[model samples]
Target: MHVSALWRHPIKSHGRESIESVELVAGQTMPWDRAWAVTHEATQPSAKDGDWAPCHNFVIGTRTPGLAGLWARLDEGARRVTLRHEALGELTFCPDDAQDQARFLDWIAPLCPANRSRPTGIVSAGARGMTDSAFPSISIMTTASHQAVAAPLGGVLEPERWRGNIWLDGAAPREENDWIGHEVRIGGAVLRVEEPIERCAHTTANPFTGQRDADTLGTLERSFGHQNFGVYARVIEGGTVRVGDKAGRA
Candidate 1:
């Protein structure tokens, strides 16, 4: 198999940015991926301590599907993020600045579901990204598996909905399921497949339209007998991974 794409989400449940290459470090999520998240006003106090916490402490796509429509670009050197939305235009702000955090809150407030708690501030996860799993991981998906899921849905599903960090081609559908406890070489990095990524309500929403137009979880259960689409792997060897690089069992 070969790596077909690489993507990162600078902010949790906000937006995804495509990159040609990235350096993977052992025991860490992708650089700037979910580095920051918007904390809701009613979030638990433990979440405000700037440490890793469950995704429920922040505004996420599952709760507010409109977040899927937002896009982002991160300027690591400048410590700034520029967010774009069709209705909100573009806004750039430094996540560390208090004022800028409030500005970001204001911009996204309208996008929040009316029934949900509103965003109060942006929270950082420090060196570790705010991933869904408690342990740091990289999400991996295969083109054949995606097509298999799409086949039952009667439509082409967008890879963005899976929000996978690595997309591979030339693998059989569901082949990665058997990769657990085994090392896989992706580009120059080596990773051990840890577990399957269970499908969630977030995948039901369209990344472009933010509408719940697909029953992805249902389709997975009916077609695959399980609610899973991707695998989460922990980096074992650190190196730069580029698009088009070969991927195979290490």
Candidate 2:
């Protein structure tokens, strides 16, 4: 198995950005994966509630294939982000304000191209219940795992389908699953493997084009007992990560 790629989503449930390399540090989370998600203003037991706020909350893959096309960059100061997409021109979202949030959502919605009507304003889901249960501030995966799964499915798997915060190269196939309970050193940082990530419908949704293909799910179930193909991890040390950094089990 080998570490082949890395990625992060600046805005939750929107899209992902692939990187040649990255550093994993403890405590410091990656730019996006869970940085933001949409939620309903009124409390409801079901996630399907239509009263939810827009882009500020999490998005579903069933509606927009383009939502997966999101890409972003963190400024040198690591304080702001520049968002981009094929449909929408480049834009930025700062960590400020109600008005700014509204504009951010409006900008994002058009680019997302979701089938459903989206809200104009974006709101936070609060700190609690804001992310997936397996979400760690940072996560990692192996290229071999991608190959193991993709090889069976016509030799191509979009990185966006997995939605991982970090991608690694130069590791054994499916090696991440074996790293559980171990702290893996990545670039100048270290991350502890928490558990194997469980599969979800989100995996079947293509992040780039926002298209859904049932065959993707069938391929996963047939190739791997479970649809899951990655793991969740937490940073144990802090440091900057860039491409070409060495990754290995600590």
Among these predictions, the greatest lDDT belongs to 1
Q: Please state the error at residue 205 of candidate 1 in Å.
A: 1.1
List TM-scores for all candidates, in order.
0.97, 0.75
lDDT score, candidate 1: 0.90
Give lDDT tens digits, candidate 2, residues 133-188.
Answer: 53444567777777777787778777667777667777777888888899887777
lDDT of 1 by residue, 37-116 (tens): 88997889999888899999998998998887777899999989998887788999999899999898888887898899
Poorest 10 consecutive residues by lDDT, candidate 2: 48-57
Hey, what RMSD does candidate 1 come out at? 1.0
TM-score of 1: 0.97
Residue 87 error for model 1, in Å? Answer: 2.4
